[model samples]
Target: MQTETLTLNGQPFYIRRWGDPALPPVLLLHGFPEYGGAWEPLARHLADRFHCIAPDQRGYGRSWAPEGVQNYAMSALVADMAALISHTGAPLTVIGHDWGAGVAYGLAMFRPELVARLIIANGVHPVPFQRALAAGGAQAEASQYINFLRRPDSHKILAANDFEKLLALFSAKMDLSWLSGELRAAYKAEWARDERLNTMIHWYRASPLQVPEPGQALTGLPDFPRDKLLVRCPHLLIWGQDDTALLPEATEGLEHYAPDLTRVTLPGVDHWLLHQTPAEVARRIKDWMP
Candidate 1:
């Protein structure tokens, strides 16, 4: 694998690439508070047959952290992805987890031509997400962390203690034994490099629930075209059934948005399925893709 940096939409992004450049691309997007390197093990497994490109999304790891809460909005994030695809010069099979999964959905909605296939792990479709939040039942319970992240001082507090708490959060939720000590140290080093916690907190801070536009539907944006909405490309969804952050109920009707979707539920896996079951996850992804 090799690491490189490029500017996309005026924001600097750090990307890690594996396999031959001539092959069809598989672009992986990591979730919030995590970096592109998170996909290293999985990328290694897929590199024999696919070109894997994983970028540290804006405000995470070595990537540029732009100011202002608005910079972290879904639209802007999708633009960053578009810029990445344009830079790479290839039709891509996009895969995302958590917050990255949300960005993947936005890409399919806003720039379907760039994507040939889609894979999402542990996230709900945007339309249903909006409806669930408004319905205020299980979604509210699943999303309590959103409110916690929205607090004004949350970022400062999380960063103040040298990311001790943040590291603990990962250790508690995921099986960190898969990550070698060197890799874990590297992640901690990157987390300490910038005010990443504050920048990342802006994702939740700028979300629809916190700042709704007047007269806007609870969804907060125009519904994507229904005809175009169904991801026509081959799609795969692997979910960690025990995810507390995004309940299984949230994913109940995902097929409505992805009619071609193939889904797998991991019985005992949690939100950090990538780490908890990296080999299983990678094998499933490889088998799912053409």
Candidate 2:
């Protein structure tokens, strides 16, 4: 594995690269409470065949994590990625998980030219995700944590006690065995950086997504241009049936947005399926990559 710092929108975004640069590039985007290193396990499996490029993304790891909720707006987050992709000067297969999926879908919908293919690991599309989040059902309940994370006091509370609450948030009914002792230390060390945790929480704060409470649906959601939200490229979705943070319902109408979509479900795994079954996930991605 190799590491480098690429400036995106004047911010130094740290990236970890694996495999020969001459190979086809597969851009990997990580979610919350994790960094580019989170893909180290999965990249190891695909290193021989693909150039696995994983970025720490804004507000995580060694990347330039700015302050304020406005800094983490989805547009800004996606723009950072768009610049990174533009820097590559070629369309590439992109893989995303959790919040990373948000930006991935943004690229597919808004800047389709930069994405050759889209692969989502336990991620959701905005339209389906928004409908589910507003439905006040299972997905709404699952996403209530987003509200908690957006709270102003959440950072201080999560920071207290050596980030005990943050750790619990990560293992929420998911398999974390893939996060070994060394990996755990790495994550904790990243979180320990000044204001990193707060900047991380800002992502939830800046998001326009709303999580309605169970039995109480939301009305008058922000107008989203559905016509422009289509995923115009081949899309692959890898699902972990056991995920608790985002139930299957959240991604129900994914096919509507992604016409050329293929889904592969892996049983006995949860949100952290990439870590638990990196080889299998890599095989699925490799088999599906076009």
Candidate 3:
């Protein structure tokens, strides 16, 4: 893979590119606590057939991370992606994991013309996630960390003890064997960057989803207009069943918004499926992409 710095939306966006630029493009987006390089393993598997582009979205890695909570809003996140696709001058397949999947869903909803196909790995659509969070059950308990991350001083806590708390967030009943000592060192180095940790946390802070207490009742969760948020493109959702942070309920009723949706559940895999099964993830995407 080759790394390049490009100017998008007047900000320097770092991206990892693989394969010939003349081939079909596939945009890859990584989630929090990880950068574009996180997709390296998967990109290598698909490079022969597709041109893979993974960006260090706004607040992570070497990308331009601006200040203020508003900068990390959903609109800004989606626009950043729009600008990136426009830079390529073509509509292409988009794949995201975790928060990255959130941006992909937003793109499919608001800018469908820019995405040919959508592939999401353990990402949630707004409705089911908010409903699950507000309903107050296992998902709500699993998401309590969002409240903690939203705290103003949470960055300090995450940075303490060499980011012990942050590391714990990545491993939750999922496989950790893939995260070797070298990879762990690399992640720590990436997290140790100046302001990156705090900036990345802003994604959680800027979100509108409400995570209710385990048994608390919710009242004011934002209501999404079904018509405006429907995704028109062909969509594929790949889920890791053992994901503790995002329960299976997150994918329930997703087809209401994505009429042409294909769902695949990977048993025994958890949130770190991308790392645990990169080749399998690539195969699923290749077969689904056409």
Task: Work out the TM-score per prediction.
Answer: 0.89, 0.97, 0.97
**lDDT tens digits, residue span 89-109, model 3:** 658899999999999999999
Worst 10 residues of 2 by lDDT: 171-180
> So what's the TM-score on candidate 1?
0.89
lDDT of 3: 0.89
The C-alpha local distance difference test score for the whole of candidate 1 amounts to 0.78
* Predicted candidate 2 versus true structure: per-residue lDDT over 36-126, tens digit per residue: 8999889999999999889998999889998888888999999999999998766998899999999999998989999999999999998
Candidate RMSDs in Å, in order, are: 3.7, 1.2, 1.1
Stretches > 4 Å off in candidate 2? none
The alpha-carbon lDDT assigned to residue 114 of candidate 3 equals: 96
Candidate 2 lDDT score at position 200: 85
Give the Å error, residue 67, model 3.
1.7
C-alpha positional error of residue 100 in candidate 3 after TM-score superposition, expressed in Å: 0.2
